[model samples]
Every structure is written in structure tokens, then in C-alpha cells.
Target chain A: MNPSMAITEAPGLFTANGLTGLIFLVMMAVTLIGGLIACTAERLVRSVAGLIVCFIGVAALYYFLNSPFVALMQILIYVGAVCITIAFAIMLAAPEENKKNGPAGPLSGPLAFITAGIVTIGLIVMAMRAKFTSLPKVNGGSVKEIGIQFLTSYSMVFELISIVLLIAIIGALVIARAGRSK
Target chain B: MSFLTLYNNLNTFLYLAAILFGMGVYGIVTHRTLIGMLISSELILAAASINFMAFNRFTAPDPTVGQVFTLFIMAIAAAEAAIGLSIIIAVYRNYKSVDTEDLVELNG
Candidate 1:
């Protein structure tokens, strides 16, 4: 019944399960490292790369959370679409030659870091202290169930989102195109 | 609390989300460029989604709700990104710069 023992008894250090776990760990590392780079890198392009890495990590995390559908969507949307779009923006708008000067005010950079650190610590402490009672599962959150819930319970919101997306697309095209003539 | 069961703990995900949120805040506050700020905003939204999914996995009665909600959030985020980037492009064309410091034409 002990799967860990069975896993360890396999010849190589990388059994199927162990290899999966290792890959997960590596992905986690990539995610965190990417986030750090995205937040701290001086260059915008490097930050975009970090964002891609972090997103891939998030997708992996989604898979670990038992939502492969969302995970794939995350990769497709965030990495495939968003990051590439951002890269194009970086190229078009952001000047590559300008070195990042320190923040505007004298205390801006340090103050921002301190503020972020404090907020992170406070939230982590609160989360750790809170009492969370586990609830019984009504139904397994399968892909079929997700589809049914999307249509039934969240149909209004789903429809609204489609409309919002449509508006966004038209608005983006309008705004971006408005400048080309001038 | 145990190291071996880190993935099973709700708090781990919460702390991760918290970190992501804080990083997003820092980026938003400090980034000079509009596009960078938008990217940071996306990070904040992703952090919120993580928190939702964590609660969904650990405590929600109907877990599909959270997943669906997260999906909606993703959709909104995608649209937001598209719009935001286009706005950035438009602004760059008008002002010739994306730096927040230089966007002072409305100072009057």
C-alpha cells in the first residue's frame, strides 16, 4: 500500500513518479526565479522573458491543482498570446537603449521594496494563523462538471465576459488605429 | 506544517499568492513605463486567481465554481492586456514616451 516505498525500490533515481515530482520541483523553481526576474530585472525584455517563465510555472501549478484544462489554457493564453504581444509592445514603444535610472524620488525604490515586503509578510502571517476548515466535496471538479457549471451557474458572467472581450478587441483596434492616420 | 506535505497545505498557496501580490504591487508602484505597470497588474490578477483556486481546492463545497471564476478572470485579464497595450501604443504615438514622469501635459 505504501507507494513511496515502491517508488524508492525502482532502480533509477528517476522513476516515473519521482521524475514527475522532480519536474514539478524544477518548474516551481523556474516559476519563482522568473517572478523574481520579472520584478527585478533592469531591462524590459528580460522581464518579459521572466514573465513567460513565471507563467509556465503557473500553468504547471494549475496542473498540480487538478485542472489540466485551465493549465493548458494558461499556457496557450498567457505564454503563447500575451507574452508575444507584450514583446511586440516592448519593441515598438520602450526604448532599448535607455538604462533604468533609479526610481524618481530619493526614497522611491527603497520605500517601494519595504512596502511590498511588509505587505507580503503581513499576508503570509495572517494566512498561516487563520483557521481553515475543510469542506466536503459536493462533486469532483471534473472538466464535464466545469462545463456544466459554466453554462448553468455562471452563464451570465460567461456571457458578460464574451461581450467584454468583444468590446476590448474593438476598442483596442480603434485606439491603435486612430494614431496611424495622424 | 510538515515539509513533506507542503503541497497539501492551504497556507503554502496563500503565502505564494501573497508573495506574488506584493511583487505586483512593487512593480506597479515603481515601474516608469505604462506597459510594465500593465504587466504588473496582470501579476496581481494572477495572484488573486491563485488564492481563489487554493480556497476552491481546500474549502469550497462546489470546486468548479472557483475554477470557472478563475477562467473568467483569465478572460478578463486577456482582454485587459489587449486593451492596455493598445492604449500604451496610442500614448506612445502621441507623447513619444511611455515614462510616467514625462506624462505631465495635464499639469494645468
Candidate 2:
């Protein structure tokens, strides 16, 4: 079912279709490089920056998956909220200056690499080989549909999440405020 | 089968998520600081969401279900980050350090 031209002939460099493909390729590169930087960088600040880049790429991937709502939420939640919160923690906690040189772990260097590689390879192989029965979509997972689902099916979870967020906020303030000198 | 058309394939996103999860595991294992570990844990969560989303896009009977699940994941992750960072702050205030090595009061 694959087109011969799709493989043998490259899509035109100037066309819109080609541009989307190009953008996807770029997003993939950004995600990979950002993840590598996030994992490997010695400094905490740079790692946070890399995390932002990685999240942006993931957002783009969500866009490709056809859920613009989730994609926007990915950017808003991950890049705007989470990354900024982490940056604030880095500033307040000051991981860089306080970073002590020590043995990372007995499994830090190569053993961790091998284990991660194995996990990655196993998952990829499983994903590639598995056959999914494509069930017909009940409703288009649009933003409107999502809103309805929140109000209808997922209302309980929705309320629970709000309570969780409230608790998390109050708990955070209380914990961080404790023992702070006036 | 074209490289440019990877966006159409379910396996592409799956492989991507797997790699991201692997990176997360590696980061958690190797990072010496609590904040760094938290950052890695976020990566793992992101990977899981991507998997849910990919299935939602491709084969799910109720597409809204996966999206809703992913949304819940984001909320949980946010809350987790908040609580975790606060704990790290408390730990830092007490110990004056965030390194796991220095945090070994239980080491026998």
C-alpha cells in the first residue's frame, strides 16, 4: 500500500507537505538533542533549559498527532508552568554551587547506559511487532469533546484533580515556609 | 515507508516515547541532585503521556479517554513537581546541600 514515489522520490523542498515533514524531522531532532542535554549536562540550569526544549518538541509531536488542545496544554503546562517552577527551585535551592563532587554511583556510567539502552530497544521492538486492532473512534477527541467529557464522564476525576492541586499548593507553601528566618 | 512520513506511523511515536523513557531512567539513575531526579521523573511522565496520546490518535475506541487520561497525567505531574520541589527546598534548608551523597544519614 506504500507509494513508490514516497520512497524513491523525495518530496519537493518548497511545498507545504514537504515543509510539514521537514518540521516533524526538526522536532524529532530537537527532542533527541534536548533529552540528551537534559540527561547529560552537569549543571542544573542548563538541564532545565534542555527540558524546556524537549517539552517544546513533545508539544510539536502532539500537534502532529492531531490534538492541538493537548499540544497547547503540553506547552502551557510543561514549558510555562513546570519548567518555570523548576527554574525557581534551582534558583532558591541553588544546586550548582552546592553541587558536591562524589562518585555518582556504582551503576552510574556505563551500566546505566546499558540498562537504558536495553529498555529502549525492548520497547521499540515490542512496539514495532505488536498488532493493534483499530477500534472505531466513538467521538472525535476535539477540544469541545474534551470539555464535554470533563463535564460528563470524567467529572469526578476533574474535581479530584482540582482538590489535589489545591492541596499541593497549600502543602508547598507550608513546607517551603517552614524554618525560613524572618 | 518513506522517512518523511514517519509522522503517519504509530511505531514512530512509540519508538520516540521509548527512547524518552530510557533517557528518563538513565537520568534518574545517574543524577546526583534531587531536582535533577525530579526533572528526569517528569521526562518519564511525558513519555507515558505520549504513549497514551499515540494510542488515542491511532486505535482507541474512545479517543477522548486517552486524552482525558493524558490531561490527568499532566495534573498529577504538576502536583508532583510542586510537592517534590517543596520537599527538596526543605531538605536543602536542613542539610545545606542537595547532593544524594551528602544525604546519606541512613548509610550504615
Candidate 3:
């Protein structure tokens, strides 16, 4: 049964749709590899590097999702700002995980893997089974439309997030500054 | 649905998000350090955003809503990262280690 969504017939390898699919597969692979490295890397620095690669792949995925502005912001905020801040924290905290010399806990490695696998399988099954109703597009969801909605419909939420971010910055500075004299 | 056109399907994005979420959960459970947990949390957040965007692209009546929501999530993630990293720094300063096991004491 064909859903309402676009499901093109198989295109030849040199066709535009085929090329786009190929690129998407590459991006998907990049994202998974980076996430694997980030999760399993021995060093924090290498993990951060992997996180960077993962964010870039996610940004590309966002572009494929038809929100180029969101994709660009994803790159700017996540890859550029957030990852850089994380790198700086790594330098400052400098925790090398030297203690215990053994596994993190009795139920950490294998148990964690099993738990994650179960959770993933459950989510995938649920998603596959659920039938989502598609509504006709009201607007193009362009950057302009997003801006208008932000200033109009979502103005309160926007302001609240701004305040929350300000508070977080101040709180972070205060927390980091404490016990510095000791 | 052919593999070549998987990008146009909602299920593909959902599956990708699920896998990423699982990886995040695994990272959080297995990681011993605070920063490492923070990194994994970001992955989880990304997974959530992907779900939002995928739905926005395929099912939403007003598509801008999900995009707007994703933008808010990014802001929140940024703030969380800032606060979390700062707390980690403070914890390190007090205990000389950022490992979860080393942070047993509540005192400064």
C-alpha cells in the first residue's frame, strides 16, 4: 500500500533522484560512524571530534528535511558553538578517567547495550505501526514564515527561552566561579 | 519503497532517530565522566529534533511549528550544555576529578 508520501519508482544510478539518495546514504553512514566514535572513543578529545562529525551529518539531514534555515542554524549552533564550548570544558576539567581501572559498573557495558537495543527496537516497532495523518501544508515554512510565527504566535515562548538562556549563562558563571579561591 | 527513495519516506527518518537515541542511551549508561554524559545527551536531543523535522516535512499542517520547536530545542540544549559544563568544572575543582565515582561528597 502506498502512503500519501512521495515514493518514486526506482531511478537509474545516474538520475538526479538516485544521486540524491546516494548522498543521503553517505550522510547517514557518516552520522552513524561519528556517533559510534563519539560514544566509544577512549579519549574525550576524540569523542568531541566525533561529535563534530556527527553534528555535521545531522545538519545535512536537516537540509534534506526541507528546512534549510534550521539546517544552517544546526550547523552554527551545534557544530560551531556548542561543540567548541564542550572542547573548552574538556580542556578545563581535564578528566582522564583514571580511577577504578575496571568497568564502570557491574551492569554497565553489556547491560547498557541490551537496554539500548531493546529501547530502539520498541521505538522502531511503534513508529512502524503508528499511522500518521498528513495534512495539507498551510504555509511553506520558509524562514520568513518562521520569523513571523516567532514574533507573533510563539512570542512568549521565544521570550521565555531568551530569559532562560540568560539565566543559564549567569548561573554557569557563578557555579564555575565558586571555590576558585581555595 | 525502494532504498533509493528512502529519503522521501517518514519511516526512514524515524528509524534513524531511533538508532541515534539508542546510541545516546548506551553512551549515557556506559560513560563514566560528566562531560561524556553531556555529549550523549546532545545526541538524544538531536534525535528528538530529527523526529520533529521529519514530521514537519511530511505530516504537519503548519510546517513552521516543528521548525520553530526545533530551534527552541537548540537554544535549550545550548543553555543546558553551558550549565552542565560549568557544574562539571565546579565538581572537578572541588574533587580534582570529573568521574561520576569520584563525586561522592556533597560538601565544597
> Each prediction's Cα RMSD?
4.0, 2.8, 2.1
What local lDDT does model 3 show for residue B104? 74
lDDT of 2 by residue, A31-123 (tens): 988998888888889889999999999999999887999999999999999999999999998755547322296656788799899999999
CA displacement after TM-score superposition, residue B98 of candidate 1 (Å): 0.5
- List, residue by residue over A80-172, the lDDT tens digit for candidate 3: 999999999999887465633223878678998999999999999999899998888999999999999999999999999999999999999
Candidate 2 local distance difference test against the native: 0.87
lDDT of each: 0.81, 0.87, 0.89
- Scored against the native two-chain complex, candidate 3 gets a DockQ of 0.71
Q: Model 3, stretches more than 4 Å misplaced?
A: A1-4, A95-103, B106-108
Q: Is candidate 1 or candidate 2 better by TM-score?
A: 2
Alpha-carbon runs more than 4 Å astray in model 2: A1-13, A98-107
Name the candidate that leads on TM-score. Answer: 3
| Model 1 chain A: ten consecutive residues of lowest lDDT | A1-10
Fnat across every predicted model, in order: 0.55, 0.64, 0.75
Task: Judging by DockQ, tell me the better candidate of 2 and 3.
Answer: 3
Report the error of model 3 at residue B24, Å.
0.4
Best by lDDT: 3
Q: Report the error of model 2 at residue A112, Å.
A: 0.9
